[model samples]
Target: MKHVKIAGGLGFIGFHLAQKLLDEGWLVTAVDSLENRSELKLALEMELGRNAHFTFLQTKIEQVDFGDADVVVYAADNENRAALEAVLRKCQPDCLFVFLSTTDVYEYSGEWRVQPVTEYGKAMLAQEENIRVTCAETGGAAVIIRLPTVYGLHQPYHLKLGRQFVSYEDETGKTESMHDLLYIDDVTSALAAAMAIDSGQHTIHLGSGTSNPFERTGKSNGLDYQKAHELLGFFPRTSLAEGIKKYQLAHEEWQRQKKLAAMYDETKSMAAKHPNTNQ
Candidate 1:
C-alpha cells in the first residue's frame, strides 16, 4: 500500500483528502498540532481514529516523520511557514509532494477581486515558488493545485461564503464580481488524482477560470478546465444549487444539535445545583 502523510490532516481540506485516501486503501498518517482546535476538528479526529489504516500524529509539520512515504500532501494552508522549507527537506527522496494552494495567488480573496493581490496572495505565491525550487533541489516530484473557495460540510468561515451561508443563514449578499466556489469533494477528487501521476512538477487550476458574478448567477469563468482535465481528468460534478442545498441541510442539522446540546447542558447544571432533584 502507498503511504501518504498529510500536514494539517485535521483541517477542512486536509481532513477530507485524508479520509478519501484512507478509504482508497492507502496507509495514511495525519500530522496536526491541534493548536487551532475546533468542534469540527475534534469530530474529524474521532472519525479518522476509527480507521486502523490511519495514524494521527499530534505534532507540527516540521517534526513529522515522513517515513518511506510515497506522498506528502501539504493541505494545511495556515501552517507554520518558517518550517516549510525544513519540512520539505525531510521528505523521502522519491516522495511526491502535493501542495494544496489557493487562487489567492491571483485573486485577492474568495471575492474573486484580482485588482491588487493581497499580502496573503503574495505569501501563497512565495510558498509555491518555495515548493518548486525546494522540490527541484531534492529531485522529488511536486504538484501545486490552485483552488478557489471550497465549500461543503465543516467549511471554514473566514475565507469564503459557504460557512457564512450556513452559520448566518445569509446567502443573499451582493457583490459585483462573481465568485466560483468549488465543492470540497470536487477539490479532493482532483487531489486524489495527483497520486496516480508517476512523476513531474505541475501547477493545476481546479475551478471556473473566471470571476463569477454575485449570488452564483450561473455565470461561470467560462467553465474552463483545460489544464486540470488534461492532467487529472478532473471535472466538477456538483452544481452550485446542489451544493447550496447540501449546506442548507447541514445548517438545519447543526441547529438541532446545538439545541440538544444546550438542553443537555442545562439539565446537568440544574441537577448539579439542586442535588435533591436527583433523588
Candidate 2:
C-alpha cells in the first residue's frame, strides 16, 4: 500500500482528504496540532481511530519523520516558508509533494497571476514558490492545486460563503456575492486523481468553473462543471441545495454537543460544592 502523510490531518480539509484516502486502502499518517475552531476533532478522532491503516500524530509538520512516506501533503494553515522547505528537503526523492493552494492568487481577470490582493493570498503564493524551488533542487515531483471556495460538512465558517445563507439573520451582512465554489468530495477526488497521474511540477485549478451569484436567502445561479470534468474526469455531484442542507444539519449537531458539554461541567461543579448536603 502507498504511504501518505498529511500535515494538517485534523483540519477541515485535511481530515476529509485523509478519510477519503484511507477508504481507498492507503496507509495514512495524519499529523495535526489539533488547534482549530471546529468542534468535530473528537468525532474525527473516534472515526479514524477505528481504522487500522490510519495514524494520528498531534504535532507540527517540521517535527514529523517523513522518510517512509510515498507522498507528503501540505495542508496546514501555517505560512512558515522555511519550515515547509525543510520538510520537502527531508522527503525521499521519489515522494510526490502536493500543496493545497487558493484561487485568491488570481485577480478579477480569471487568469493565473502572481499578484494577490490580500495577505492570505500573498502567503499562499510564497508557499507555492517555495515548493517549486525545493522540488527543483531535490529532483522530486510536485503538484500545486489552486482551489476556489470549497464547502461541505465540517467546513470552516470563514471559508464558505454559504454559511451566511443558512440563516435569515445575515451574520456577514452581505446580501449577495458572485464567486466560484466546489464541493468537498469533488476536491478530494481531484486530489486523488493528481496522485494517480504522473505529472511533473504542474499547477491545476479546481473549481465549478462558473460564476454564480449567491444570495443570503439560499438561492444561486447555474453551475458549470466543464473544466473539472475535462481535466480530472470528475464533476461535482452534490447540488447547492443538498450541500447547504447537510451543512446546516451538521452545524446544529455541533451546537447541541457544545451545550451538553457545558451543562455536564456545571453539574459537576455544583456536586463538588454540596457534598455534605447530599450525604
- Compose the digit string of candidate 1's lDDT tens values, residues 76-118: 7443476777678988778898887666555433333433255
**Backbone collision tally, model 1:** 3
User: Which segments of model 2 are wrong by more than 4 Å?
Assistant: 35-39, 110-114, 158-179, 214-231, 249-279
lDDT of 2: 0.73
Q: Write the per-residue lDDT of candidate 2 for residues 198-242, one digit (tens) a residue.
A: 547877766564444343433443234455566567677766666
> Which whole-number lDDT from 0 to 100 does residue 255 have in model 2?
79
What does the lDDT read for residue 170 in candidate 1?
43
lDDT of each: 0.74, 0.73
Model 1, which residues run further than 4 Å from truth?
107-116, 158-179, 209-223, 250-279
**After TM-score superposition, what is the CA distance of residue 220 in candidate 1 from its true location, in Å?**
8.1
TM-scores of the models, in the order given? 0.78, 0.77
